[model samples]
Target: MNGNVTAPLSWVFTLVFVGFYVVAYQHSIHLWRWPYPRYILVALSFGMVLWLLVKMRFHLPWVTYWIEMADYAFLATLMYGYFKIQDKDRRIKDRLFQSANWDALTHVQNYAAYDRAIGYHFSRSLIRHNNLTMAMFDIDHFKCVNDTYGHLAGDEVLKQVSSTVVDVLKAKDEQIVLYRTGGEEFNVIFPGYTVAQAQPLVQEFFDRVKALRIPYNDVELNVTISVGVSSLHRTDHNPLDFYKRVDSHLYRSKKMGRQQITLE
Candidate 1:
């Protein structure tokens, strides 16, 4: 009975070696979508250790003394380590998705996210005839800042301006859509707000920005922004028309001397 139970050295060696190779290959392919490769490596290492134990049990004379206990300990550690890594990956993925659609510096929705949010809001507000306003804002003489200070300083200025605008807006009942339209330019969509209502908010934003003194290199740098506001009226009017009209107003504000607001 003992002899029957015990496997031959050649059989045990061949089977365990081949099995290890198959598991190793599959494990390698499994790493494609996995967040971390270390867990897989640990699991593979433990598996290889188990195969070594099986070979030891059959081929080595003193296998019964240590191989069985070591195999169990190794398996437990591998499982614990794998689960820890998996949990960490899940948390990181969640946080990434939440922050993905927003700009890091301004904390405003990014351009693509702004488009989607606006489209959804417009569809729902169509039946209600709720007021919608879109405005474009561009910093006055932004290139001068880049020329005088390096791009890093210019970036700091932009961050300051964006933070100022975000702080001035009201976010009580209606959701505000804000985005960086381009370099030194930003776009805002205020749903459930008409031109008249959006005017004061925009004006307040302008005043706040005009008063802002951003610090760079231990010096206070004065900054100002020009704003253009437009309302979405007709159901047939596309979002582009609103953008163009506001852009025109933005240009007009710039041409007429900056630190001003124009509405159309």
Candidate 2:
């Protein structure tokens, strides 16, 4: 048994070696479809077939069995290492994908994510002939807050506001997506709501924003936001058109007075 035995030196044994991976792939397919009994049967059948081939067909020497056992251990170790490396690569890829879509500061959806969401929703709405509402918002007197409180405080305020808004939106029944489209600006997509239907929810969001106060150092800072809403149009061709329409209402709200909502 301690001797080096090369039993699988022939073409027939090589084919059996290749058949292991083939059966492993079939096992994966069965597992994917939630057929537990079929998968287990296949696994048992594969083991029986391989064992029968090794024992009955290639009955060379007892030392061959021991050597083959060692070979299997080595292959198991190699496969474990390969799977570990693959898992690490997948985790790194996931982190990079998340960072690209999320704001580094506020942990909200960034502009890139916002752009993707717009295109996705636009395509879905165009296909289903559905209505989509967008609300574009900016912090009111944000410069004053930054200049008065300092940059660190500004960051804290942003974190607080974003967290607060996310909490409020999550409590509602309707599906809404939040995005930090600019430094002090955000965009929200309200799926399956018209401009009029989105008003009460948008107002609730503004009220929630007004309710949150951040305590930094000894001072408690208050933050308010101006919002503009627009419904999707049949004439619109692209995501940019939907953004422009909502942004126009936001511009008007900011021009008239800060900390208000305008719907168009």
Candidate 3:
């Protein structure tokens, strides 16, 4: 505490301490995220500055004054590096969530994400006495498309079908959860709507899908979809059972005929 900060040795010590803080702070990714390392770096950098001030007894010598620039540099570098790292981390997290939640082919929510969202909202709706409807949508004659136009055209049909469904149900209050649940099958969860309320919406969506004119190899393709709707009620059944009921309706729709809506 009694060391003379005006001494040349004090300037050397200040530089050494600042350099150490820079190394430890920048290389601390092994144990900490951005702000944590930034915090430590800042504290250490300030501590070095404080040591210089105290050594000089608060009167900075010419050499010590020049060396104070290192403090500013340290702060700027740490702040910049911190936010840079944080931004990278945030982008990575977003990519991971998208990969997990979104289907690769159709870019809608995958089944895993759909189940989680539906189950969560379904439970909350049951408790709050809100209305919710679930639908299982299947592309009718989809296998025939694959057989007739080849698998690439089939994939295009799937993508167009998904886009059509999304475009038709563009209401904000309609919390729509759509999933390509394997093969040519898709599932939709419509929260804040009853089975009856969702009927016309589902029909319109199916009609629009059937009306799509997708192009492949100089030929325009047509497709149709079958939808099954079921509502969730307080006293009705569990979530899985509710889903199963709609799934059965979906199968029945497919069995009876393509391009139809079956509600149960």
Candidate with top lDDT is 2
Candidate 3 lDDT at 152 equals: 98
Writing each residue's lDDT as its tens digit, candidate 2 over 65-153 gives 55665675556556656765896899999999999999989999899988888999999998999999999998888888889988998
Candidate scoring better on lDDT of 1 and 2:
2
**Using lDDT as the measure, what is the rank order of every candidate, best first?**
2, 3, 1
* Candidate 1 stretches greater than 4 Å from native: 1-86, 95-99, 170-174
Residue pairs clashing in model 3 are 5-55
- TM-score order, best first, reads 2, 3, 1
lDDT for residue 123 in candidate 2, whole number 0-100: 93
- Candidate 1 matches the true fold with a TM-score of 0.64
RMSD of 3: 8.7
- Please provide, for model 3 over 1-264, each residue's C-alpha lDDT reduced to its tens digit, 9 standing for 90 to 100: 357668766676677677776766666565456655566566566665655655465566767655665675677667777877897999999999999989999988888897788789878898899998988988888888999989999999989999888877766344676787778888888888888888888888888887789999989998888888998866766678888888889888888876788997
* lDDT values for all models: 0.75, 0.81, 0.80
After TM-score superposition, the amount by which residue 167's alpha carbon in candidate 2 deviates from its true location, in angstroms, is 1.1
Who wins the TM-score comparison?
2
Per-model TM-score, in order, reads 0.64, 0.75, 0.73
